[model samples]
Target: MGLLVFGGACLQGVGGLGFSMFCAPIALLLFPELVPGPLLALGCPLALLAGLREFKAIEWGTAGYTLVGRALGAALATAVLQVLSGPTLSVVFALLILGGVALSVQGWVVRVTPAASSAAGVASGLMGTITSAGAPPLAIALQDLQPAPLRATLGCVFFIGSVMSLLALAAAGKTDAHNLLIGVLLLPWMAAGFFASGPLARRMSRTGVRRVLLTLATFSALAVLAQGLLHSQA
Candidate 1:
């Protein structure tokens, strides 16, 4: 349990770039039973806290569409994950994030506009559903914005999505007694991460943050591939 808590905090802290790419997969792998249930439940707080810490920086105008996109994306993910094998879904999602990271690092991040919001939202909904991977499209959509607003909007979208997701996952019977127990056990770690959000944001510039996120995405890709390989061998 201690290990799970630490794993959650550390993975999220380094390079998830205000996203849940690494944290969600790690949570599912380490505690499969709690995934999309307690794990998702707990993760929302981390995103919420991170976003709020940079509230002043949030690009309030475009944030709403991102939230709407996230809600739709969460719905789509819930549907897809219901039908897909866990390993397959994880690997696919990992690849998606890896691609986004690669594109960004290669200077391919397209400047986002309101017109891109709907399309990005659709993609965001689909990917985020399977992997809690809610950052890719939003990153593109918010690319033109400054770091403060960018991260802030991400925080808001994630928080909103987390709320919607919790409800959706709960309605689907993903949440249960065991899930609650895991959440309780992980409260301290979640609290600690939330507490540290301010300091974490101050530690990096936007480009630095994006680079870190891309790095994490690469690591996530390898991790997913490894899992697939291990599962195949098994």
Candidate 2:
């Protein structure tokens, strides 16, 4: 597991999405029992820290508008999933991600107007709750903003939302020692990636970034598909 996390760090060093896009799938392979629930819960702290680190860069009007609907959507997903069987939920979210990928390919960009942002917040919350895979829409929406605010706002929102998610998971009694260790172990990786972000972001071309993101997303999705096909713990 530690070795897998080290791999995660290298991927993260390349781009910001590796924690979820790379680490999560590999972790899923090694620890299916932990994936959609407990392990996902532990990682919320890293997500929270990510956002909080860029708190100053958040646009109040935008974040405030977005969070309202996001909270609502998160609440909705939580309420729904509390009763659903695990397999059912997995299939549902897999379909949704397939849809998102399709949307991405179809030139259907998510606009970031006040109304759209709020709507996307709800989508983010729901999608995040469903799969812990919520960023494509928000990323596309914020792509046009200045890079600093764009990244900072994302970090802040992910952090804040993830804190709420962790609290929810804890209340549900899903945590365990292994996941705790996983989150702690990821600390150094997250720090290194965050520190290196300055130069890496500067050096990365947008086209290159998008290509990397797409490739990693495909790999992650394929990992999930493989798990489903092989009747692994999905």
Candidate 3:
């Protein structure tokens, strides 16, 4: 778990994506307690770190527009959580991950207008609140931006979204000391991975990094979907 968290965090530090999307599926298999709650808790600090690191590159205008959408999406997600069963939620998350991957690979040139930004934000908020895997939507939305701005703006967006998810989780009684302790325990690993990312970030092209993320995201989503199927069968 620590190693996975470290790797995911390192990737996020370098590419501004993949921390939760990579970690959450594996964590669901290995440590079921650390899914949306602990991951969201951990992501708050990790995202803030990235946002601060590239603060100058952030597209604040887009961030504001997306945040407004996130507010709406998070509210809807909170409502969804009230009635959905665990396996159902897992399946929903899996589909969302797969859908995001499909959109990314399709080469659709979506203009980042305010309307699109808010729509993407709403999607991200819903997915992030449910699965802790919101980056794909935002990543696709900002794909046309410069790599530095893309990464920085994403980090800032995630920072705020994570806070909202954590608060919602806490209100739903899904967050507790156990989840928080797990998040705290993984901090050092996350920090180590983050530092290691500096070299990798310099070496890899943005396209190459995004390709890797797409592959990992697809695999993670498939894995979770399989897990959900098995759980439902059981």
Cα lDDT of model 2 by residue, 30-60, tens digit = 7665464443543454455445555576676
TM-score of each: 0.77, 0.71, 0.83
Per-residue lDDT of candidate 3, residues 91-119 (tens digit): 87778768877988887656888998999
Best by lDDT: 3
What total of clashing residue pairs does each candidate reach? Answer: 2, 3, 0
**Candidate 1 vs candidate 2: which has greater lDDT?**
1
Q: lDDT tens string, model 1, 1-234?
A: 545655555445433343355565665667576566676667677766657667787766566766666567666776776798656876776676567666776788766666566567767787666545556556544555556776666667667777887887778886888888888788787677655545665676777666655565576566666675676567
Looking at model 3, the pairs that clash are none
The residue pairs in collision within model 2 are: 48-159, 51-155, 51-156
Off by over 4 Å in 2: 6-18, 32-45, 48-56, 78-108, 212-234
Residue 23's lDDT in candidate 1 = 60
Summing lDDT over every window of 10 consecutive residues in candidate 3, give the lowest-scoring window. Answer: 127-136
Q: Give the lDDT of residue 114 in candidate 3.
A: 92
Model 1 stretches astray by more than 4 angstroms: 3-7, 10-19, 74-96, 139-144, 221-234
